[model samples]
Structure formats: C-alpha cells, structure tokens
Target: MLDRPTFTISNVRSGDVVSYPLVLFDGQLHGASAATSVTVSRIGADHPRLRAHTYTAPSQAWPVALDTGVFKALAFLVPGENVIEFRAGAEPVAAIHRLVVHYLNAPWDYCVRAVYVVPADDPVGGFQAPPHERCDIDSAVHRLALAMRLLQSALAELMHRHGLGRYTFCLEEPAQARACPSEGGYEEVLVAYGVPVHVHRFKHSRAALQALSGDELYGRVGQALSGAPDRESRIDVALMSFTRKDAHTGMLYGHTALGGGRLALFGSGSMFSWPENLEQVPRRFTDRTAVDGRRFLDDSAGRGEYWALASTSMGAVLHELGHCLSLPHPHNGGGIMARGFDYLYRLFGVAEPQPGAEMQAPDEPRLDRSAATRLRFHSYLIRAGSEPHPATLYPPHPPPAPDGAVSVPVPSPSPTPTPPRPRLYVATNGLPARARAHHEAHSAPRRPSITWQSEGVVRVSAPNGLGHIGYYLNGDVAAHEEFFQASAPVHLLDIPWREVCRQCGNPPAGAKIRISCVDHAGQIEEAFERQVGDRP
Candidate 1:
C-alpha cells in the first residue's frame, strides 16, 4: 500500500497566477503500468461548483514540477488565501488545499484564438512509461493541454453555428506530448490548439464526479456564470480525472449523459492515447479502443468507415447542441428525426470535412441545410428559466406517432436538395416522446435500384451499413390524425422487400399512400399522393 499524499491550498487576490509542486516520495509508489495524470479543481458549495482550475503537466512518474492551466486562464488571482481541492480522477484526492494566487502584474492582451494541426509521437502500448526509466510526464501533460485547446476551438465553432451556450469537455486520460523531456513538438501542440485541459479520473462508480453538481455542467454553465465579466467569459470548460483497473478493454473511454443533464467521459491509460491532430504526443501504436477511435480521427489509420468516427464522435456533440436549439434531425427521409444521416456526401459527393481540415478564410464549419433545420426545431423545447438545473434542456412534449410509418421516398437520382415534411412520433401523455420515421414515399419509384426492409414494424433502408427504419402510423395528416391537416405525398426509400398490410386495419386497399414527416425545421409537414401498388 502507498502512503496518501498531502497538499494545501491558499487564496490569491483576483488577477494573479499561482504555481505549486507535486511530489511523489515513495519509491515503492509506482505508476500503474500506464501514465498517471493529475488535476486541481475549485470546490465551492454553489450551483456549477467544483471547477477544475489546474491540470498537472502529464507525466509517467510522480513528484514532477506543477504549473496549472486554470491559474493561467484566470490571470486575475487575488493574493489572499483560498482552499482549492485536488482530484486524481473524478474522485477527490485532497480537499481544501491551501494555495496563494499571486498577481504576475504582466499586461497581456487577448484576441480570438483558433486550433491548428500538429504531429504526435508514439508511446508504449499503454499510457504509462516503462518502470524506472525517466517517465515522460511533462510531454504527456502538454499533449493533453493541446488537445483541450483544439477542442475548445471546435466548441467556439459550434457556438457560432448554434447560439452562444456554455459547455465544457471532461478528460478521461493522461494527455501528454513528449516522453520524459518536453520537446518542441509538445510546445507546438500547445501553441496550436488553445483550449483548457483537465485530468478526469476513470471509474464505473455511480458517484463519479460527485464534486460537480448538475447546474455546473455544460447545459447550465452559461446561467451559472452569467454574472462574470464579458472579457473573461468562457464558452467551454473542461473537468477531468483518472482511474486504475485490472482490465484493458473494459470501456476504457466513453462518454455518457448523467441524470442531471451532465455528461462525463471515462477512460483508462490504454484508453487515452496521445493525440495525432496535435504535435509531439507520446502515444503508443497499440490499438486501444478509445485511443484507436481518437487516433482514427487523427493523422494515422485513415479510411474504412472513417466517416463513422467523425460522425459518431462529433455527431453526438452536434445532436446535444441541436436539442438546445429545439431542432430534430430531418424526418423527410426514411430515417428518424434523431438519427444522423449524411446525405450531402452520399449523393452530391459533398463529404463532411476531414478532421483538422481547413476551410477557406472567413468561412468556418457551418451546419448543412438539413442539419440547420434540425437544429432550429429544438427552439420549441427551450424552457429557459423553468428548470432549476443549469443543464436541464428537454423537449416540450413527446412527438406523436400513428399506428404505422407513413413514408415518402426521395425520387431517384436523389433530389439535389431534399424538401421538408411532417413526421409522427410516439406521444407521451400528450407530450412528445421519442420520434420515429414516418413513411417516406418516393416522388417516383425506381425498380431494382435500391433495396429496403421493414424492422421493428417500420420500413427503412441501410445507409452506409446503418439500418434506418421508419414506423407506419394511423392518423397521418391526410388520413385524419388530430393536429395533422396537411395533404402531403407519401414515399419510401430504397424500397425493401416486404408483405403488404391493410391500410388503417382493412384489406390492403390503397394504390396510393400518404405519409407524414417532420421537416428539417421541426415542423409537422406531410407529403401525399404516394402509390403503394403490388409489385410483379
């Protein structure tokens, strides 16, 4: 067993930067076969409390010199005494550490910063350095810092596209740049990506991040920090920690939403790899799932469903922000309003931008037309001050779905730009529940061109190997469902092989079918004049 480490905290006058030293004395105190990262956070008893203020420069060994980022960002530390808390992973390691934040008295001007690309160095199969060898702890910390900065830049882009909202990124691993010695590469990464970094502890415990409340989370951070000065405003904040476990592949790193509308990411050393988009990262070439997934989006391992990486990784972020905007995914196609379908590239050869790829000057990454519509739909859900929690953003009510899916297929040679339609969803107590795809009928049918299938009682198709199914409903706008009053054409996509069922519970009677869809803008629009005839 290792002796518990002790530390203190002191208050600094506002507008000052403070520094501390982290020492690991026990020679027997060895780092887990992976790199060990640490961070310091402020724990106050208020809404959105427990803010991570400093991330220890990542390292493989203990007892390293400590210069934290949080101190740097808040250049206005007071010279008084304060108690800052120290957390290893997400758990509290040392509470109420006394520290002094002294003013540097240096004049520093600020400007809009951006994220640039950097190269990375490979580390061992795991996060830790080989035992006894000079562990490259400094490089690791710097690398993590750079990654945080880059993500911050991305968040800015997201904010510009969506409305201004406060959010934060939580870390799950020891982010490092070089091995033992900090090198130019690590420096490059830090300078290139300008975001904050945190050392999040990895754990399966339900009590993880017990320090931070729901209001302090991203969804509610804006209101919590609303009183802060504008120049010192932060759009994205990051909280991170680490963990120790015997397994390698047991959910090394993954992100999930907490009940209070908070989101956290957990990962092991093997799960946290050096970043490729940043420079001089000391990461191993091993195929750690988390690292591999991140790496795939990085410089190496390019190709083979790679878009899946970008889509899955960044798609959730987009979706979450979409919810804040009161928007839903486009429901005009054969997919639900919640699922992501990249039709721009699939049809028009307009691929999503590659990670770290640059756009023309003055042009930042903007949501496509479809994505824009989906985002706007969320406007209906924004309750503002109704909820006590800062991050609590929920839909006003559940979407209403009929007995079956009413689909309108996109015509062959897919339309240059898809139109909007009404979508039906399952209603929860008169409120909207999870929305599903209503049938999408093609303006015209093409034989043997594409295939479709009905699963979970919904007819849909597979896009890039993802099965998209829509439900058949009863009260469509054309068919007489309450609140549905539009006469829209119905269609299905890549029509799949299936048996005909009765329309509204009678013998299959309609040579023509009507479908409902939710437009990109979250409106309940409909398409009519669809023909569901017998195929010979």
Candidate 2:
C-alpha cells in the first residue's frame, strides 16, 4: 500500500504579501526508495515551473521519508492575483496543494482629530491635574491639563490596538467655551419647568448638530485647528467634560453625526469616571491584571481606581471611535465594539476584582475572525478609491434574533439530512453557589444549562455523524476535532474545562462557550453556552 505524501507551509496566509525565505517543512515522501522530486509551478495562461526541489531522508527506513525545504525568493508572483502550486512527484499519485496571492497596493492613511472640550464659564476647571501639578489658583488650567493628558494617553492606547498600526490621531489644543446653542423658546419652557441646566453644555442631539454647518462645528474647535476642512479625510471628535447630566441618558454618554462631516461628540463623565467602590465595577472589568504590568501615566502601581478609570476611558473612547470609523457593535461578547465595557477593561489589564468578590470575571477582549474580516473589507474599500466616511464605513446591524436565540440556520436540501440544531452541555464543580442560584433561577426548558460537578468538563454529543467540530470560547476559536471516515458513529467529544478556559484567556467566572458542528454531508449547526461559575 502506498502512503500519501504530506507537507506544511509556514509563516504566510492566503492573500498575504510574503517576503523572502519562505519556510516549508514536514514533508513525507511516500513510496520512494531513493530521493523524491517536487516541483513548484505558477499557475496562469502559461504554466511555468518556477523551480524543483528534492526530498531525502536522513536515513531511509521503509515506504516513507521525512524532509524539509525552503524557497528563498518568490519572484514568480506578479502584480495582481497569482496562484502558486506545489506538486510532489508525477501524474495521479502526486500530492498537490495550491495557494493564491494578491499582491496589494500601499495601504491608505486614515486620520483622526481629537478635540478636548471644556465648559465655557470655566474653560480649564473640568479637568484635574496630577497631585504635583495641582495648584490652589488657576484650578481650571490644571483641570484642562489633566483632561488633555488622560485623553492623549487613552487615544494612543486605542490607536495601537484598533488602528492595525496604520491609523493616526492628532490632539489639538483644548477647544474652550464652545457651547452648543439651545433653541430660544425651548430654553424658556425648560426653565419654567425648573429643569436644571448648564450654560456651557452642547445640545447633544442629531437635530441640534444638523442645524449647524460643518464650518460652525469646526469653528468651535478653535482657529488653529480650523483647517480640518482642508483635510477632508480627518474624523473630528469633540471630547466634552461636563458636570451636569443630560435629560437623555444617551446624550449624557455622547452622540455622533456620521452624516455631519465625520463628526462625533463624546462626554468625559461616562468615559473617564470610575465608580467610587471597586465592587460597583463589573467583575469582568477588574478580574485580570495587565500582562505586561504596564500602568498609565496617572496610575502609579497600575492596578486600582485610577488605572481602572483610565483604562475604562480608553476603552470607551475606542468603542465610540469604532462607531466613528463606521464599525458597529458586534453580536459576540468579545472586542471593543461588543455590548459591554467590561471586556475592554480586561483587554488592557487596568482592573481586577478584589479577592472573594461574587461577580464573574470579565470575558477578555479579542478581535475575532469576523471583526478582522470586516476591518479588512473596509481597508479594501478605502484602497479601491472609495471616499472615506469614517462614520458610515460598515453596514448597520441586522435585526435582532428572537429572544434567547443565538442564531438560526439556513435550510438544507439533503435527504436523510442531519438535524439543523445542535445541543451542548457543561459540567463544572467550580460554579459558585450564587452563580448556580442565578443560573437555576433563570433556567428554561430546551435552553442550554450548566450543571455543578467536582471537576470541569464539557461534553458534546451529536446524533448525526460529526464531520467537523469546532470549539469557540469567548468568541475565539479554541480547538477543533474532525472525523474523516464517511460512516462514523454518533460522535461524542469530551473536553477539559481547564483546557478550554486556558485557550480562552482564563476568564475567572467561566467563559462563553460556542460549539459549531458540521455533519457528514456538510450540514452545519451551532450552539452557545455561557459557562458561569467560580474559577477552578
């Protein structure tokens, strides 16, 4: 019997622009007594063999030999789309694999302008400086300086993570006394009703923003920064530090007018302030310490109220900026664009829960495959000469699914088709009593359930033959299992909970576990389970 030849490619992905010294290894030369031949060909109108390499075993044993090869230069790839194929040996017995390469043009430069806003009556008093910089006189100046410093540092961190190292932002000198004008008669009605008001606050509304032209908003950013219109590509963000709450909660946080020349309004109160009590912060936000032990400029030891506040602010800005860049909040629980701020705080390692806290640790933040693909698509659009509108870059969110439903599967046409739904279960001894109580209280029939045990283990059983099974924890692919036989038994997979958690960044209160399975004929099904319990 002839063994099948196998090989592996290293350090390059499909469509990636590769550099020199391509590493290829783990070649098994099958059914060869002597040296085996391999040819590299560029597939096109005229298929040309780029080069030939030989595989020889250190000491030949029997029917197979192991070897490695390297390609020094990839001069064969042309400007646009190119296909590279590797064939081992000749004719029908040869093992062949192909890779497609898209040699891309230079990436586009996306720019963002961060404008700091202060109250008109007290232009400098909204921000607070460091202890050493604090002065009894000119407190406003100190406040403005502190606010500017915090925002700058936060923006820097934000850019490094989401910008893919290509986006840049400029911090303009603080925009002072630039209050949004209120409607003449509306202010009188609010005053008659005894509604509290702040004179320097901008009216955070779409209609209010639409009433002013781009030039009027640009003017508020100060004369030195008024040239942004000349740089039509820039995303203008006004960071307002306000003491009074807006009538609407959404307005208090901030608002963006994507149609209004890529402009966004962000309130510092929600973004920069941390709750006085550590317990008040979500468990996920304060569960993990920073991996690098890096602290912010204002944070001395790197894990406390100051660090939490700074890190949270950075995450909030990143989230709002993501919207500014035309990206929407993802359905998954990971990444800056997700529903909660806890993941962001955990991603930066700025906070962790005090010992013996009841709350589950925050799920760590990650740029999953979907988010990366969306970003890449946006980049491609920018590179293809599409006018960049930082606000409307991505498509809007699809309508929500039925309550408690994760996802619905597309219809299938196969006879003897596999079930369209898959079931998942978890057994963990590490779940806290309170968490268990919460889970049991909210448990529903047919819904995914968590069971208590002495050890943590996840068991996945499929009635239909399992062709491919993938395990995802907290939105990242953790592990996968495959069955190649055409007629395999009902597949049962048992995975250690510790192993799954380890692959998912060790979220303390357990991680969100998602399992996707494909049947023998390629019918796909998915199930989601949130593993809530004490850390094992």
Candidate 3:
C-alpha cells in the first residue's frame, strides 16, 4: 500500500506567540495524490474542541508544488496558558502537535483594592453582613465580585487571542468608605405609591453622595495604602463602589488613567436594582471557590436569577475596566463596548428568547483584531514600565498640506493634458445580483465593482514597481501581500474569509470587498467589490 501522507507542524513550535485572528500552520502532506484534509483543535479538559477543518488540493499539498500546503486557524485563545493540538485526518493520520499559547507578559501582575462606599450613618463600612438579620449591602458586594470575575475572564480571552499569557488581577481586602459631608441635604421622594414625606425619608431620599473625580480618589487611595511595604510589587487598581451617581455628570461609571496604576468607579444603582429579599443573593459570592488566586468569582452555575443579574452587572464593570486597559468602544457594532445586551448575546454567540432574564452572561467576550492589537501594544508598554499615551500608540492622521506649501498648478504646457494614464482596473468575477444591488445602493461611483470567488482569490495586473497589495473587507485590512518585483499578474489567494467576516461585523450574506495596491513610489490605487456568501 502507498505510504500514508506524513504531516508535520512547520511554522510554530511548542511555545510560540502567534498573531491574533490568523495563525498559519505550514506543513507538507507527502505522497498524497489528491486533496486531503487537516484538522486543528484546541485541547480542552474533556476533549479536543475543533477550531478549523480545511482541505488542501493535490497541487498545493506537496512542498515542491508552486503553492505549499498551509492551514490557517482562527484562534480566540483564553488568557494564561492555552494548548492547541493539530492532527491530519479523521483518524489520527499524523502525530498530534501541541502548542502552548500565552496572551500577556509572563511577569505582569496587578492588584485591585475594592472600596465599598456607604452612607455615613452606617455603622460598619465596606461589605459586611449582619450577624443574624440580612444587610442592605449584600447585593452590592455580590454584584461587584461577579463583575470583577467577568472582567478578568474577558481580559484573559483578549490576551489569549494574541498569544500572551500570565496576566492576573489580584483582589485585595475591601477598603472602608471615607466619611464625607453630604451634599445639599436630602430631597424626599415619594415611596410605595403615595406616602407621607416623613415616612418616605425613612425608606428613600435623593441625597447626593459626596463626589470626587477619579484622579482625586486615586491619589487619596494611594496615600492611604502608602504604609504597605510591597507597594511596588504590583500595579494598583482602586475599584471604588458608590451608592450614588457622580455629582458632576450623573455618570456612574468612569475610570482615570490606563495601565500603570488607575482608579475605576462604579455606582451600585447603575449596576442592578436591590432585591426585595436579601436571601436571593447567591451564597456562592462568599464561597471559597469564588476566589481563585488571581482569578475570582466562578461562572459555573448555569441557572438562577442572581446569575443573570450578576452577568448584566458584570458587563457594565467590564466595559469600564476596558477603558482602564486602554480599549475604546467600537460604537459601530455590538460587543462589550457597544450599547445594550445585544453585545452580550453576540459575544456569547447566543440568542435570548426572554431578554428580561436577570442571570444571562456571555460565555467569553471577544475583541476585534484592531482592539486586540491595541491592547497588546499597551500591555507591552506597561510591562516595560512606561505609561501608555494615545499619541504614542496611535499616531494622529496627517494634517492637510499648509496653504504656503501648496504649489499653484502651471497649466500643463502640453495642449493635450497627457492622456490620463489608462485607468487601472483590478479584474475579478461579477458580483451576485443581491450583492450588486447592495453595492449599487451604498457605494459611490468612484468605487468600481470587481469579481472574486468564494476561495478569496483575486487577480490583479499592475505596472512595474508594485510593492504591496492589500485586501480589505468593509474597510479593515483582511490580507496583505508583498512583492519584491513587479509582475504581470499577481494573485492574493490567502485571504482568510472566516477572519475577514469577523472583522467586517459578520455580515449575513453580502459584504463589501476592496483591494488596495501601493507601488514602490507610495502611489496607491484601489478597487472595490461586493460578494455574497454563507456566513463565515
């Protein structure tokens, strides 16, 4: 019998940090006469979870062929250490190769000092339950703990996608509220339908809580904790929880500084409504299992109203923390940073029939490639002991040419304005009717339609000096190709459609495709097209 094809992992080894979204696995399937299949799976505790299943044609299976076989896996690694296994065939045709992925710098660590703010009259500050009777602060502490856990999980997933590991969040002992004078006295509001003002004061009042800007609060906390000898061991994150909204903006969530040391504030009222029965709060909040070293709170339980509340509250907390980590809101679409539960559903890849459930949480939130890249860059700076600056991370767009620098056009001396260099066009197949209609409706006349196949192959013929070719989906660069010398025809056949769809907001069927080319002189040319395909 002919020898079974031999498969090996060529590009990555046991410990390697691959880029986010796309991880290329280069290997040869020897002695294969026809197309063969390969499987890439993430090693899990119970079983191997399939990540990608792609086939290679005969012409591309051998190393001697013009196009060597390479499998691209879309990785969404969790933070810390993640293991992925590769195999060739449905039944172990090749020895499994294991890869360890890390999402953060190995020695990076930070501690979060949680401060629970309560009314001055309250005897004991911070989170404390009564000896026998239920306490009012039970729900606040429960939600805060749950939110922190979710935030850690989301950050881990973001780091994992980029292949860094060992990022941790240590929750320190809760700090007591600092006594501050009440602002403007209390304004009585009606409670329980219509009640006497005197009685309403006992139940609820619109008394403003003393407010301090995030910067001011951070300084105060830093001074209060200055006595600790291990101050330099880890970065400080002051997680201040309050009973009322910020007096200045009425905003309940905000943070100051990102990386190094920072302060994140949360208003309990903004997180969740108080439960009528304090017993409703999950006992797991205080469970030993909830606090796992640098990792805290567990999302193991799949049921209960408190879980849903915790999940929703956690979303808010995670969103604010994202800011502290230098992540911006992708306001254009749904994600943790976007508005509403739509982002949560999309993150977990679930549809909620009953949107009112108090215990719904995303399985794991995901970061787009751009956001992931930004976070990785900031994390690197933090590990290197530098404060992150927006200008340093993302340079400002070039300013328009100054008026003095603009040269007046001397009417081209040639009577015939040098025949406009023949309009360059990128050749591709025609778009489907639906895609064509969508393009015609949304695109401008300057953008031309180019045809492309489902395999992500695009043909281009350009003048000499072509330095690079870029393929974009919905404005985001999806693939890049570099050329040493200009050639008659060039093809970009490695655009990972799965990742492209993801970056393009995972359109239902039709998506906008654009091709941009930059010549050696830096002159840029582009063509736009649309395609309809099954969801990636």
Candidate 4:
C-alpha cells in the first residue's frame, strides 16, 4: 500500500481525493483470501440510494488500484464519519470494515489491541457463585456483548483521537446462524441474519487473557497493523469472544493484537454466566488477602498505555477508556474527562479540565494522542448502527479527608523492675519534634501505659488510672504485648539525683526530659518537657 492511498469522493466540494494509509492487517488479509467475492456499497446516513463498486487484485501484484467504477461510486459517498460494512457472500465468518472516510484529511490510522469484559461477579474472576436454579445465558451473553462493544468503542475512540481515521469489526458468522432470542444479540443477528457461521473452540477467558505480556500485545498489534496485504478488502475491527471472565493472578493483564492491528474482544464466561442487571460486584478483602496492603498505582508500567478498574457500568468503561487514551482522571484533568463517579466528584459542582489542560505529558506513563485516536475509532465501531446519548459531565471532587482540629492523647508512666547500676545519671529538659507529637496523638488511646526497667533492675509500679504513656528520648513509637516496667516515681534512679546534680556541675540546675505514652484510643499521648530543682 502507498504511504498515502488516494480515493476520490464526490458529492462534496473540490479536491475530494484524500489519502490515509490503510492498516493492512492479517485478519483483513485472511478475510480477503477466503472471501468468495466482495461488493462495496455506499449507504450513507444522509445520502440517497446505495451504489456499488468493484475492487480487484492487480496483475503485477505490486499495489492494486481500486476498480475505476468502484472509485467513481466511492466518489459519490459523502464524507464526514461514515460506517461502511464490507459485505461477504456465504463467507464462514462475516467482517465489516468501518472507515471514517474523511475527505482530504491528514494521515490517520487507529488500532485496538486487547479488550476487557468485566462481569458483575468477582472482578478478579476467582470465586464462583453458587449456581442459580435458573440461569439466563442469553442475558449473560447480552451483557458480555454490551461490555465488548463498550471496550471496542472506547479503544477506537482512543485511536481516533490519536488521529486514526479507519475502524473495522470481525466476527465468525455462527454456522447455524440462528436469530438470537428476540431482544439481545441484535447487532450479530442482523449482520449474520442468514449467513453461514464459523466456530472456534475457545472464546474468552478472564483469568487467562492477560497471558500475553504488554510488550507482546503492543509489538504484535503494531506489526499486523502496519503490514497487511489486502488494504481495503476486509473488515478493520476484529471481534473475539470469550466464554469465561478473563483474569490472571493479579488485577491486570494484556493480550496480543491478532491479525494485524485488529482489535480483540474478550467476552468472558461471566458474559454467559452472570445475572443481568447486576452492577458492582461486592468484594471485601481481609488483612490476609492479596488485596490487603495493595496499593493502586497512578501510572501504567509503559508508554502508550493506560489502566482501569472496572465497575459494571458504561461510566467505568469510559473511565478506563480515558486511561487507555492517556487521559487522566477528569478531577486531575479539571473537566476534560472528569465525572461524578470518578474520585473527584465531592468537591466543586463544575467539571473543569485539570490545572495543566493544554499540557499533554504526564510524569506517569500514559497513552499518547495516537492511542487516543485509536480509541475513538473503537468507540465509533461500537456505536455503529446505534446512538447512545453522550455521558453526563460532572464536577471536581474534594479530598476524602477533612482539615480539622488535631487530636491529642494523655500519657501514663508504667512500672519497671531492674538491678542497681553503679552509675546514676539524670538529664533535665527536652523538646519533641512536631511529627513525633502528632504521631502520639493518633497512635495512643485514653488508657495508655508504658513499661521500662530501672538501671538497678528494681521493680517500679505505674499509676492504674493514667490515661497514656510515652517512650522517653526515642523518636520512634513503641508498642508491646506486655509491659516491662515494674513501678515508677517517674524519675530515673532512686537517689536524690536532682539535688546532687545541682551541687555537682550545677548542670543547668533545672532541665527535664519528655516522654510519650498511649491513650484509650490506642493512640499516643503528646510530649511535654519540664524543669527540675529550682528554689521550690
């Protein structure tokens, strides 16, 4: 294919010939090879009747020109975002290539790599619910299809925003080609209404889908998209289905872009397994679970990448799409992509683009315009033959924690038992760091206690009703299952060291040490320094 393939379209202004390179993908190549025959027809949303065109393979086999008749017929097809389904006759699998068909636009192409279908069950797909007596497989399939379409559309939008102008969808025409139960499977039913079908052994699996590493998925999709033999003969988007909810050991995973940059759809078992109308699978993690101590990351591990956490809604999918397109949370974006459901909803009532709206680069890894454009393409593909009202926009949310009074705790000294030491020393005054003081307030509770051994190994008892206790001198907070102190007058050494110290070096005559203790709330008490041995 030429770096630019010129296609002339009429029914518009001058210079209708626009050239955007077609992504020659393997699926298209395979589709063309197997297609007994193909016919290109212009069925515009606003245009008149349908017109047919011819596309033939070349003799020299270098680069083939679309038939002149086909070119003329294509010329009549009006521009500005169109869905062109490449019709297949008796082909085992049907394919539809949806090209945005822009007139004289810049070079553009979009690609959707792997897709997700999060279920209403375990988001991770580990636990299986007790099988219900009545199962609604059709409903499950519908949800699966809905999720797939959302993923496809979001990815296409990402690609389109990145400047890709073409989109496609491929699915195996079921052999029986039976009509899906009245309500669900409308798209598939209409497309493959009377066509023969092709069957695949396995469809989608949540746990196994992430088997493909990020690099593998990226490289393979890029390669297939850049180099396929048949440029315009086959469908662009490739539809893959999964029978099981796709998952791995972790929350994240990726898959390869098969058949040349064609998008992959992973319809998991949950699609055919979960009850319809279910949203937000409730999950709780204990301290021992993997989710415990786990922190969600702000960035993806690579360039041209994004991340998502699934909720059983289109909004959640949109949020993920934002990530996939390299768009940050709208809260951070100000308003460009923010929504109430996202983390930023509790604050201001208006949705505003983040502080640096014009700036594109994020310190963390993200998708570029190229990826976003591709996502737009997927979005177009998913919304094909249908219209969904645009999502409602919301405002920025405030932080979860509030700014308020700092809470503090009182301390109690515990007893200590120890052997007598030859040396007895006393230090007077001290001041604690702000961090240490704050930490004590939160860590210690109302009934706090401290334990430490005396230098003489003497036993010291502590006040029974003391509220909190603090460790002396050390900046680190201390907690133990059992107390070590026997008792305490709260002074170091049994000697009248204060008078002795005053007599000796006159050691400033009145210095004091501060300590931290626990309180009733299991938090630490604040530190207080005192003066010793004045005239009193």
Candidate order, lDDT descending: 2, 3, 1, 4
| lDDT for residue 154 in candidate 1, whole number 0-100 | 39
Q: How much does candidate 4 score in TM-score?
A: 0.23
Tens-place lDDT digits, model 4, residues 1-536: 21212232222222112212111111122323333323343344333322221111110011111222121111122323334434433434444333444321111112222222222222232221114312233333434433433333233323333233223222222231332221111112321111122112122233443455645544433333333322222223322232222233324344222222232222231122221321211110000111111222112112111111222222333344344333333212222233322321111111112224313433222223322322322211211111111111101221222233221111111111132211000000011222323432333332233332343121222222222232222222121112223343232222233333332333353554233432222233333333344332
Model 1, runs deviating above 4 Å = 1-192, 198-239, 243-370, 373-536
| Residues 329-440 of candidate 1: C-alpha lDDT, one tens digit per residue | 3323322124432211111112223334412212223443433333222212111111122122222222333733322211111112124333321121122122211222
Q: lDDT per model, in order?
A: 0.26, 0.37, 0.36, 0.26
lDDT of 2: 0.37
TM-score, per-candidate, Cα-based = 0.26, 0.31, 0.33, 0.23
Which clashing pairs does model 2 show?
A: 124-140, 125-140, 127-143, 284-361, 284-362, 286-351, 286-352, 286-353, 429-453
lDDT string for model 3 (1-536, tens) is 34555555543455543212123344555544343444555555342322221111111111122134443332335433457665554343353456775432212223443434444344332332222323344444444443443344445444444443312243432221112222422212111101011100111121323344655545544454444323433233333333333445544432232222344444343333222222222222211222121112122233233334344444555565555544445525445554332233222212232355523644334554444434432321121111132123212222222421111111111111222121121110022222322332223432222334566644443342344555566654554455532333233224455554554556666666566554322234565455648432
Q: Model 3 RMSD to the real structure?
A: 21.5
Which candidate leads the pack in TM-score? Answer: 3
